[model samples]
Target chain A: MPEPVLELDRLVVRYGSFTALHGLSARFAGGALGLLGPNGAGKSSLLRCILGLVRPAAGTVRVAGRDARRARSEVRRRIGYMPERDSFVPGMSGVRALAHLAEVCGFRPDDAMLRAHDVLHFVGLGEERYREVAGYSVGMRQRWKLAAALVHDPDILFLDEPTNGLDPRGRARMLTVIDRVRREHGLHLILASHLLPDVERLCDEVWVLDRGRLKMADSLERLTAAARGAKRVRTRPEAAAALAAAARAAGLVVADGAAEAELVLTRPEAEVAPAEVFALAASCGAPVLGVRPAARSLEDAFLEALEGD
Target chain B: MAFRATEYERFTGRRARRPVWWPVCTATLRRGWSSRWVRLLSFGALAVAFGFTALFYFAYQVMPNWPTLLRVLGEDEGMASGFPVQFYAGLLHVFVYPILLPLSLLFGHDLVARDLTSNALETYFSRPVSPAAYVLGRTLAYTGFLLLTTLGPMLWIWAFDAATGPQGRFGEIAFVPLALIQGLVPVALVLALFIQAVSSVTRSGVWTNLAVIVLFFFGFVAGQILYEESDRPEVVSVPAASGGRNEAEPAAAAATTPAQAPVPAEETADNGPEPTVPADAPPRIRPDRLPLALLVGAALALVGGDPTPLLLAAPTLLFSGDRQDGRPPAAASAAVGRRGPPAGAGRSADRRPAPASPEERIVVHHDPRLLAVSITEVIRGWCLGCLDRSYPEEVRRAQAGRRHRFRATEPRQVPVDLARNVLLGLGGLSLLLLFARLRRQGTVG
Candidate 1:
């Protein structure tokens, strides 16, 4: 098997006596892994540790099977990072900063410059080569920063709130750019965001962390199923009781709401699809209603996991 | 394969290309210079030049004749004042040029340290540039800015003298560069070194610049005390008189033996001498003292170069006409054949090589032990211990010139002198701690 792109074992980070990361342990396979957390939940800190910016006080962090804290330069060379901050080398045109950053990443100056130009063009910044970064718009700056991170064509791209502080259109553009980088390049992406919708849209797997501890790390499909709520169906009055009785007979948690008919599927996604309930309802001679799929979102799961319900 | 190749060809043809780093280096340099502190420092340097020019002009007015002006400058009137043209031409060469007050203590404070306090250091360092390159490149830019601010007024004074004044000659201008080398450069160097050192050791520019202000001020205060002590060791028991004191009693003045004996001449009992002359020049010997003061002026201009403690220590170093006190400003580099009692003594033995060797230019102040500790700190900072196999023993040896000498002299007895050293240690330690903390949390990765 190919090695995990990122591995963390009991990692901890502290400031003075206060801890930012409390024994957080996680290992991620090579794919788009969404690190979902609320603010101050250590998601950004985790990405920094992987980037080798923050050294773990305890345990180990290995990026692409090499110790990240130890072989930081090597690890840095292999990864791209888009920080959430608006920090940029001001007074520089977009192309210059990217080129220099690439050079620092071990590319020869000439090749690095060429690669920087290519990436800036790729990110739609071809014309602003000499324009200083200080004047870039919020969206333009985000794109420029993206160009810098991608200039080296890194294998694993760690994005910290890349959509943050962007206008809706800007956010959409950023998402498209990030989605392309992940899809077209087959890059391993570790995206940290408080927005569950973004994770749902882009991530194959999700790792939810709360208060510096890993709440859950699994495929989005698994997490949603684990936290699945009662499956609701809309129907006329007569069939509600029959459908409720049959759902109970099938050992599903039955809830007959005043406004709708519902069946709570206790089994996870693998056991059954919500469509199966229609067949059960039909066979039991219950009047038919429109059947619907299960609804158990990452948001629900995140809250459930954190609240311990 | 043919169709795929055709598509690849088309893709390559479509790509738009341009020069890179247009944004990076330019942006980096701009943010690096767009600092308020830099602007403030530059203004301060200008203000200082103006202040000095005003003071000197007033002094020149009161002592219209060369004889009287010489006395105001504190010299023996009977001694050769180099030339009347030479004496007035090279006012900056004397210890009281007024340039040192700003460039050394004010403008030089912000060079490297400003980046750290403004939080621009981490932003710039994150790019692929090495620390050494960053320092050199940035230092060059800052020094250029400093030179312009400082030398601008001196040029004006030169131009004014050339157009209208009695000592107006082309040769008079040679004194400008000389004064720059002697009276200005050492102080500039001192300012730059301390600024950089403080910046290197502190993560914040405010603290680093503040550290410099405190260090330079204390150095000034300490130099005053040292000057007093060196001149009249007997004065140690005697309390210093208030109001003012004689220039001859200054430590820098004490270091030089009487040249041609004290030349006797009448005090300038005329036209209420230069208004800006120190309140206590006795009005008479101010003219006589001028030539004596002017005597070492040329020698001073010839010798003083870099004031970085190590640079000043080399053989046959330049001398500073240091008015404030402390070591004489000269080419008195302390290549002291590995002697003691000379940290900033900056004195060196006379040793010239037949030919330049690999280490010829390198002054190796050998300390394997200090280097060992610094190297270990670097290794640990990089987490190199994880890979036990390392470079060979000989290759691991550090360059000899960059070791620390922790042994400081009379720091306890001389609290002010010890203050800077103690602060340097503290600044270094704090940076280490911050770096370590940043390492663990991964912000610096």
Candidate 2:
């Protein structure tokens, strides 16, 4: 019911003869939305368009209901952007750079400095905040960029490849910071990344894009739930046949198994409760060990969406 | 002791609205001022200022009792008295041209280039700052440095002059500060915007600096060439009745005549006198075919009466040669004495008149087309000359002396004109606009 943080209406973007985005229209609600796309899938281009760095060839882009073209400065003031690339002044110290950017964003010098320090600490770069950005390691630079983005404390954060170019541990740390920003600060996040697990871990909704077109846009729960057509039930080999028969009689499609059996439910887990499964098992006189949804991972879903187009 | 928790705190304090360009301007200034080369250049500028100040102070103190100082030094009294303005203008020319212009390259070379190369424009443009603000901030930063080098020393000298000079001279030199600002600010602003514009086109600081240096040197060299070519003389033989020259004499006699001829190139190989153009030699441009309008325009502009021709010749106008004192170069004067029949010497034989005294037999040669060009040059020289208010009168007297010999001397008062100031100011503004447009296009980023 809250206004969408970002809305694009029939937005078309072209670079020379190559069209990067073709009539792309979508509304990103105020929450963590994953902008999932492969390389060259117009993800970065869309983000740039939202930030007003690249003008749309057709249609309109609005941030918080303000036209980005007409009220660019006002729109930018309420949004924080961490570009996918390394985008810091090379020779400047992280804190100084953040403070300077904050000042440019319309903060007083003292307030900018104080906010820079606070954000640096918040992003877990408190000790290394004084070091020159050029000398920072990849992980450190990522954290520093996050700090800079948060320094102004905008309404929404546009993070492009937030976990890009990081080791496993570094990636985990970055994701944790992103998650914290969403949960603790309660700021809307539009995270553009190719790593589906990263998106699934932090995002409430996912927007899958491929070849400059939106293939799917839905909540993570609904997307994964729809992909999951069946649930695998583990039971004693002797009771498997009886369970299968019982599941079939209950309007559930059951698959034959050598050692176990699979149950294709008539409805989603959200629609049908787990109590029904246990009751069916008791009626069939079968001992149930465990039951799990047999659905494709988010990565599989993303790839399937791309291939579907 | 009670256990305390450490965590990130949100800054909820009162936020004030700061100027969008403040951060960019301050950061650029801090970086430029902290550069070792910039610091060294600043010291050098201050050193030059101190040297001038010391000279002025010493002259002020000693000129009252030293009655023979002007005579012995062979310097004019006006120059001795009006040294502050002269020194200020001279220092400005030196600083703005040779020093500050190149130093601006160093100061602004990386301003926009670094942002583009490092992808920092994404971060900057994503903020609330607009492209115009970015350009304004960079220009201001470079202009601040330029002012420090060019105007900063002028102010120092003015203050020192007022404080240390004799009582009455301070009021006489009061206009020095205004003149310095008028002459130097436009040049500084132009250089700053020009360099920033260059910086915005490339991602390499070295390349930007090189481009700026090349542009400056090219403009200067091209201006000098055009000015010299515009001043080339036109030779016209005066009638024997007017200047008393023999018509029967061979035209080559003008070059061979011992007393009137120039010192031969071989004789003047060392430190004798500069070799003169032979009087009989054809003029660089034929007088009959001269572009009269261009010549007249150049002359009027030079005299500050009309600026149209000077505007047309703007490339060469600013580099007009230095002001000439009354004393003519020995070679020019020597060349003046050699005279023969005019161009088409054979046709004038029948119209020859009887010869007169040697001094009266002088030939007159002037470039009618170059009159404006020469006047503009002379005016520029006089405007920059150290003779104060008497400079124009001195130039007039020199023109009168030349006119007595039937040589062309169009005496005209040449003040610095408003047209020139407007042209230069427009040049700076155009560059600023260009830089802003480039910024809006996101060229540098």
Among these predictions, the greatest DockQ belongs to 2
Off by over 4 Å in 1: A224-230, A234-262, A271-290, B1-190, B196-445
lDDT of each: 0.49, 0.63
Cα lDDT tens digits, model 2, A162-236, are: 888899999998898888778887889999999988999999899998889999988888877744755667787
Per-prediction share of native contacts kept:
0.15, 0.63
Residue B154, model 1: Cα distance from true site in angstroms = 16
C-alpha DockQ for predicted model 1: 0.12
Best by lDDT: 2
Deviation in angstroms for A118 in model 1? 2.5
Can you tell me which runs of candidate 2 are displaced by over 4 Å? A232-292, B1-6, B64-85, B225-445
| Tens digit of per-residue lDDT, candidate 2, span B214-269 | 75466445434533342233332222212332332322222321221222323222
